[model samples]
Target: MLNKVFHLTENHTTVKTECIAGVTTFMTMAYILAVNPNILSAAGMDPTAVLLATCLASFLGTMCMGMMANLPFALSAGMGLNAFFAYTVVGNMGYPWQVALLAVLVEGVIFLVLSLTNVREALFNVIPISLKQAVSVGIGVYIAFIGLQNAGVVVNNDSTLVSLVSFTDHFRTSGICALLAIIGIFLTAVLYLKHVKGSILIGILGTWILGILCQLTGLYQVDAEAGYNSLIPTFAMTDFSKLGETFGQCFRVDFDGISIVNFIVVIFSFLFVDIFDTLGTLVGVCTKADMLDKDGKFAKIKPALLADSIATSAGAILGTSTTTTFVESSAGVAVGGRTGLTAVVTAVLFLVSMLFAPIFIAIPSFATAPALVIVGFLMFTTITEIKFSEKDYVKAIPAYLCILAMPLFYSISEGISIGVISYTLLHLICGRGKEVKPLMYILTVLFILKYIFL
Candidate 1:
């Protein structure tokens, strides 16, 4: 049975090979299960509960990917969506945590409905290839921004028009560490391109060891108690009252001074980011896996989207913010994960890690910083696939803007919004408006109006 299941010979795949692939995929993506909860917990949610929800959702989503999509890709709460949840919804919009969860739930329900009705496929078909490229590049920039911020390379500047590098003494340690990690990523890429096995793991491990040495030499101090471990397995009881409060927050139906217009803006913002983020991830990863059928549709995308939406809804109920498919699955796909078995393996690892949350918590962000940067570069490679010779700046401009603006704007949604709006206007100006689809035109106009008027 083991031999049959793991066979990888010319005639048959070996169980050992499958297990190796599964484990490799899981390790590559293990950071998501931990990082999502870490970010959400900062917004005053119970950390342990968020961790549980993250694990459960990831496992369930990945399982669905395996069972339904039958692809080797794994899924989890995404990086950009979580930032939108924490910064835009909760912080900028001034919505309470529970209400934000409710908004996520609503978005999930909408996503589920769209996926089930097969509207998702139609939506995928209309998204210009250039727009898709922009989305991927936008996400790469967003991820790089996250890495930079986490590494303390960029900080708020009170004196300048825009934020400047953090030259303060406190950030020096983190800054140096981040530079080293970036170097490690480049070296790893060179090695991997040279056909080195496990280059990512090697690069990450080397950087981590360097960080540890820095700590030992007193160049940097290690925070032994940085992450929340008590929040795992059974850390905090679910606050039922917070649920009602959160739901109210979601719709901005509060007695507080927050206005209805502001509430609508926040809700729509959540809906927009979550929808596009999932769409972009699905298209990018599926394209990489060659999963698109002759019709240019994901063969089993409905189920995968349904799983992603369901995970978001469940995550909100479990007391976290928005949940969506993670791009870390790209690493898994890049390494030759070709079945849902990879996701199942990733899920199992999350479950096991629950018992040792403290250990996971101990892994400094610097340790994972290299992986994020490297993955960003890996995804950015898709830019080469775009046809630059095309005369229509409508396509070229948006694609180029997406790659450049995401890292610069420090937001994936913002970059995409710019790209979409630019794409539409360019098409209209060039008198090539007929080439643009109606739904896409509407989405573009809506996004523009939302950003400008709202």
Candidate 2:
């Protein structure tokens, strides 16, 4: 039944392989179960409610990606979008969380309309093929940078903006965790080279076991205020009724004191970021998996976008930030997940997490950091497929900018923005204007206006 539905055999994969890939994918991204609540809690939300919203929304989105799109991708509350919801819109702008969720709901509806009309797909098709491959490589660096940050291997510096962790301070909590991450990186890389099945998952569990040992021996203390918690796994019954707190709150928007212009801007902000982030992740991951066709497009893209739009709208109603396709799906793709069965497994795990939230949430970021770092390398290797000739330098240069901008700017949308602008502009300047499509001209103008106004 599974094979007939997911076409597992057609994708040259087995149930065992897909299941492992799904589990690995979930393990790597399960941090959202821990993270989304904390971030949304800052927006005057119930942490427990946000956790429930996250799990349910993710289950709905990922299931859509599997059953509707038939792709090995996962969806969850986006990291940057969550921060924007809590900090920029609600905290700084002084709008209530309800109004902010309304903005997200509206944005998702807009995306749904655009996707249905093929507007989003048209925008996606205009991007040059070389730039798409560059997006893959850039996401590699971008996600790797994220892993380093999450593991405390990279720290912020007032002067330089980024620096390595000072091993001298907080040695037990910060220092040892960072060290384990570095060790995990090496361990995972070695396992990958040895061609071990489930190497990435093993790497995560191994690093987590090391952390548990540290905690058990009193080497790693529980410091909740410091963002360090007990590594030991525990089981508990979560208060399921908390789900009612956040559900359907987006519809309860109170517009009593809402500024019309500011509200529009907020919705546009969510729309712009979610559109590009979802598309960028789809293109980049497809590139790495060799899933794009000769035209450098995902064959299942319409449904994928539809699924994303559905998830976003559902997420808003569930009282979370925007939901979008996750780049961490690359971890599964890298591990040979090629069918919807992988996404289904991931979806099932998300459903199970509502019951075992604590155990899954306790799987710390440092443990999963190595898998991302390793998968980034796997994705980065596709850089060799890009053309680098003199005549293609116009394409290559923009691709290069796209690659660097992602990690440096810390936004996938920014990378796509720069890529589109530079690609179109450079081609025009090089007397290759005819090479740029009509939609390319439209996108360049739209992107330019976005920077100027929004």
Candidate 3:
């Protein structure tokens, strides 16, 4: 039955290999179970509720990917999109969390429509290879920057904009996040370099144990008042009362003046990022699994993308951010995952996470920071495939801008917008206007109008 369903024998894989790959994939991306709730908590939502929502969405989305698309990809609340929902939409823009969720729902519905049509599939031709590679690199840099900030290796400076930690004062402090981060990075890197499977998971566990030992030995003191403490794992912090309040919040979008504009921009940003992110993950992971056809196209990509879109919408309704295909799925492919059974096993693990919310939430920022950094390194590997050696600086310049602008602007949409617009203008200037697609022209105009009017 398993072979009939997942074609395990035909794909040169076994049930044991698929199961191991699924567990490995879950271990690599399980940090999201902790990170998403922590980030979304800033939006005034309950952390425990976000935890439940994250796991639930991941389980459902990944199950769909397995049953419908028969792909070995896991879906979860995306990191950058969650940060945008919290810091930009709810924090800076002053929109209610409910309305922000509404924007995610709208974006997901639009994505679903596009996926159902042939329009989304045709995007492979519309977007240039250089820009696709650039987008992946941009996301890599962005995730790494986020990891550094989360680990306290990077901090904000009023004058310099950003600065590294000063070990003089930092070492004097009992709770030294920088030290733990360095240790985590070193450990994870060493393990990965040695070809150890589940290196990220092992690193997180090792760091957590080290933190607890430091606390117990009085090397790292807990300052409860300052909210600084040792990384002790426990099941005492989960709170589910607010879960009821956030349910069905997607129906609460405001139709007022500023809100209307905010709604449009937020949805557009989520939709744009999710589309490219899923496309990149599908292409990269499937290529590694040898699931791509002779044309370099992913098999059953439409259903996979649709599953992602539906997961995003489901996540919004369940009180979280955008749920999309995780780049970390490549971790499973690396471990010989080549069938939907891998995803099925992963979905079951996610479902089990719902009962262990406090254990998941007990993971500290310093422990998981290394995983993000390492994953960023994996994604940035695509930079080698980009064509940048030619004298046609037009193509290379836009690609470089896309890579740099993301972390600089702290927004994925801005980087993509600038890259696409620059690609259009440079091509037109170089008498290569015919290469630009009608949809690209439309997107260029939409981005321009968004900048000027909203």
**Using TM-score as the measure, what is the rank order of every candidate, best first?**
2, 3, 1
Pairs with steric clashes in candidate 3: none
Order by lDDT, highest first: 2, 3, 1
Model 3: residues >4 Å from true position, as ranges? 1-4, 8-21, 24-28, 38-44, 83-96, 172-175, 224-230, 236-242, 249-273, 276-296, 330-338
lDDT: worst 10-residue window of model 3: 167-176
User: What's the CA RMSD of model 2 in angstroms?
Assistant: 0.9
Off by over 4 Å in 2: none
- CA displacement after TM-score superposition, residue 151 of candidate 2 (Å): 0.5
lDDT of 1 at 282: 76
TM-score of model 2 relative to the true fold? 0.99
Q: Tens digit of lDDT per residue, candidate 3, span 1-454? A: 9999999998898998788778867866777887788799999998878888888899999999999988889999997899989999999988889888988999999999999996677764466767777777777777677777877788789999998887566452423766887788899889989988667667767877777777777766676565464467566644556677677977866656455665787788788788866775665455445575555555488889889999999999999999999877766766678889989999999988787766655566676677667767776787786777767578889988988888898766677778889999998999998988788888788778868865
Candidate 2 lDDT, 1-454, residue by residue in tens = 9999999988999999999999999999899999999999999999999998888889999999999988999999998999999999999999999999999999999999999999998877878899899999999999999999999999999999999998769989999889989999999999999999999999999999999998988878899999999898789979999888989888887788889998999999999999999999998999998888899877899999999999999989988899999999999998999988889899999999999999999998889999999999998998999899997899999999999999999999999999999999998888999999999888889889999998
Query: How does candidate 3 fare on TM-score?
Result: 0.84
TM-score of each: 0.81, 0.99, 0.84
Using TM-score as the measure, name the better of candidate 2 and candidate 3: 2
Candidate 1 least-lDDT 10 residues: 227-236
lDDT of 2 at 241: 93
lDDT (Cα, 0-100) at 292 in candidate 3: 54
